[model samples]
Target: MTTFGAILKAHHIDYKLTNRSSLDEWFYSILDIPIDELSIFDISRSIRQDVFLEYVLPRAEVFLYEDPLAGDYDGQLLYDISMLTEAQPPSIMAILKRISAYLSQLDKHNLDSQSIKSIEKISALVRN
Candidate 1:
């Protein structure tokens, strides 16, 4: 298994030592500021698509599953993800297929309207 640090290293995203229990926490800790206030484009511009697929994409489910509005205050995983997808990286088809599956399994009834809208946008974007 690739250590979370290894993935961050692969992306050239630097971080200081910290006490974090999970990969999710470690992922957030590296960011200088909140992801919502940051531009996904800026953060991921230099990231290799293959590395994104191998490391980031596989973690999409864990990220989305932490929807803040749903009472999970983990962070804006979806926010960054949505923006990244909107950027239309070369492996977008694979991204769409992977994230679409995550979105599909969502209990839409439990999601707030805004969340639903966001998911719809992502889904629709992938289709086009």
Candidate 2:
């Protein structure tokens, strides 16, 4: 049987599945949508779409929309990496890591200098 964690991993989304009750609480807290509003299938579909549209697309777009003067940095770096040689590079893993870290910081509600540094680091990593 494919477990919830396996499904998440397959989609390159970083998640930890707890009991149904804890999952319900987390769904409510993060999405602000009640568990009752969604079936398990609905929740799974929503998570898949959310991972793609929210995290993956935006990160990919950032690389695409970089300044021309940047000298095709993202293109060159991608070309250099064998792992990203596909027509549409699989950046879901990187996107998930970034989104996970961002959400964790937001949950803490501590926007200190370290938080700013983290944002800058991620921006630099993606921009190049």
The candidate maximizing lDDT is 1
Q: Which parts of model 2 are misplaced by more than 4 Å?
A: 1-18, 28-111
- Model 1 lDDT tens row, 2-98: 5545566677978665656564363455444333332333233212223244344544544455542321232244444454444556565676667
| Backbone clash count, each prediction separately | 0, 0
User: Can you write out model 2's per-residue Cα lDDT over 3-107, one digit (the tens) per residue?
Assistant: 334445677977544557854655434342333343333333334334323332333333323421111332232222212212233464466345335433443
Best by TM-score: 1
lDDT of each: 0.51, 0.37
Give me the overall lDDT of model 1: 0.51
Error of 1 at 76 (Å): 2.6
